[model samples]
Target: MTVEVVIFVLMGLTALGGAITVVMARNPVYSGLGLLGTMLSLAVIYVSQLAHFVAAIQVIVYAGAVMTLFLFVIMMIGVDVAEDTAENLPRQRLVVGVLAAAVVGFAVYLGVSQGFDWVPAASGEPVAEATNGTVQAIGERLFSTWVLAFEATALLLTVAAAGAIALAYFRRRRAVRE
Candidate 1:
């Protein structure tokens, strides 16, 4: 088999394993680590595709910054690591699992039927220069072409943070009163 094919297979396995671990892991920390593995594998895939800027950004932004943040949050929250004490494993899980399977099936069907090709252009055309595809290009596009969407995302994050803080504060206050 070609080296490219081998690399693709390896990355695919890494991604699949990470995805499974993310779902099956009892500890939130392990799940985060699994996601980090997935990100790193994906970055390697991007590098193989000659998307050097994207690959670097993937490693730096996702595997480095985002995963670090996720680990910190998981550490701060301190989830119980025991798998045995997991409650309500049936009805809700079944529903979610069914939905996820349906989505995956539909996606696979669409992919097979459409036969989409995303091969980069091979002609030695001078592509417009881009700064390393860091979070900066993403931010620029978001602020320019998708300003409203960017604002909405920021607003959503703000609301979520506030809500979490409020919930924790209220819970603590109630515990103290009791």
Candidate 2:
């Protein structure tokens, strides 16, 4: 086999294996590490596909920054916390199973019907294609063409942060009052 083929096969296997480890690992820290492995392998696969910029972003954003955040959350929550096996709502599992099956079925239907090619929705004028993977070109495209989407995403993230803060404050207030 060609070197590229061998790399793809190895990276693909690694990514799948790491995903399994992330799901099945008992420890949160181990799960975080598994996620890191998966992200790194995905970055390798991206590099193999000649998407060097995407590979760099995957490593820098997902493998580095995101994994660090995951590790911090795991540390704060504690890796040694005992599992609470009591179900709050008894039929929660059934509901979740139904939702999962529905989602999977819909995904399968979409895959079969439309195929998996990404069709970007350009509300305004169609976005000009970038010459290369330079940050300047990406920035130009994002600001000029995808400005509305960028603004919406920023607003959504800001609202989410505010909501989380509000929830935390209210929970703390209630605890203190009690």
The clash count for each model shown is: 0, 0
Q: Number of the top candidate by lDDT?
A: 2
Q: Compared with the true structure, what per-residue lDDT tens digits does model 1 show for residues 1-178? A: 8787899999989988998889898779789989988998999898776666688889999999999999998888778744465565668878988999999999888879876555444456535653445456666786899999877898999999999998889988999999
- Give the per-residue lDDT digits (tens) of candidate 2, residues 86-136: 889989989999999999999999988886656654356424553355456
Candidate 1 weakest ten by summed lDDT: 125-134
Q: What is the lDDT of candidate 2?
A: 0.84
TM-scores for every predicted model: 0.59, 0.56
Task: Name the lDDT value of residue 120 in candidate 1.
Answer: 47
Candidate 2: regions farther than 4 A off: 86-178
The collision pairs in model 1 are none
Deviating ranges (above 4 Å) for candidate 1: 79-90, 117-178
Clashing pairs in 2: none
